[model samples]
Target: MQPSGILETALYVTDVEAAAQFYGGLLGLEVILRAGDESVFFRCGSGVLILFNANKLKDRPKGGLPIPSHGATGPGHVCFSATRDEIASWKSHLEVHGVAIESEFDWPNGAHSLYFRDPSGNSIEFAEPKLWNLQ
Candidate 1:
């Protein structure tokens, strides 16, 4: 295999299925591969993203995955694009689900974006790009 950039980001989540639901169902990503209780690999663009059991990977973080912590979520966020309607849909979905909204920022490009945390408290950004063109 040839060398390349980060092909995956594997998070140790409390609930893998929930992560899949939010990232796959809500975010509209197709599930690429899901293995038993071990881990799941997702097809994202030209690469893959993964989620492993934090408890299982605590002892050993395979494939350069982040080391599991007692409660630390580290830093930064994961971003996803949305269809115009989807972006509007998320505001309601998150509120109905009881997830706290962190902040919503407007980019100079006219992109409309919102930030929120997942069940595992990982930062996630949902964005609609057409707003950028408007800007």
Candidate 2:
């Protein structure tokens, strides 16, 4: 059987507070949990977005849970679903918050996408669901 959907998405950041400010304060994602300086969890619709401190998790002691050690370097990417109106609004909102829009364009399918970066330099995007022919 195939997995239904993603429950969580993660991105590694150098600083957790900066991530919290960007994702929670700027993007308006509700802060669900905070794990000291290691990670921050945000509620993004039905799913969760987690930002982990890249340096902190590198030597994490695996004692309590079966979760394995994981980390990533450089910039990662995540795209959120948004309609045309919402995408346009997001462009203005982000700019007012000093977030520079890296690119804004239409795909071959005519779906519009707006791209920016998070505090950790991870590529963030807002695109129409039709980008993948989804509703």
Candidate 3:
């Protein structure tokens, strides 16, 4: 059997509250849950964005199901889908919030994207739907 689709994505951050402000307050994502000061969860379309304290996750109890403990120090990346017009609007919105635009890319398939960083230095991208089209 093949995999269906992504259900969740995560980014390790130093500050959970700051991450919540950036993803929830600035980006307008719905905050689904928060695990005290450990992590914060946001609803993004059909998937979820999880921002957790890397150092804390490293110490999480490894239990029954043999779940792997994952954490990273530096930056992580996640891309969100948007329309061409939405990309433009997002660029402006990010700038107004003092988030710098790192770059913009024009793919051969006509899809475009804007790249930037979150408060924790995680690389974030907003690209048109055609970004993953194989044709």
| Cα-based lDDT for every prediction | 0.71, 0.94, 0.91
- Please write out the lDDT profile of model 2 over residues 49-69, one tens digit for every residue: 999999998878769888978
Displacement of residue 72 (Cα, Å) in model 2 is: 1.1
Which of 1 and 2 is the better model by TM-score?
A: 2
| Number of backbone collisions per candidate | 4, 0, 0
Model 3 lDDT vs. the true structure? 0.91
Ranking by TM-score: 2, 3, 1
Model 1 lDDT vs. the true structure? 0.71
Model 1 residue 85 lDDT score: 72
**Residue 22: error of model 1 in Å?**
2.8
Per-residue CA lDDT of model 3 for 1-135, tens digit only, reads 988889999999988988898999999999999998799999998999999988788778768568677777789999999998999999999999899999998999899999999988999999988889822
Q: Return the top candidate by TM-score.
A: 2
The positional error of residue 3 in candidate 1, measured at the CA in angstroms, is 8.7
**Pairs clashing within candidate 1:** 109-132, 110-131, 110-132, 111-132
By summed lDDT, the worst window of 10 consecutive residues in model 2 runs over 62-71
Model 3, C-alpha of 35: deviation from truth (Å) = 0.5
- RMSD of candidate 1 to the truth, in angstroms, is 5.4
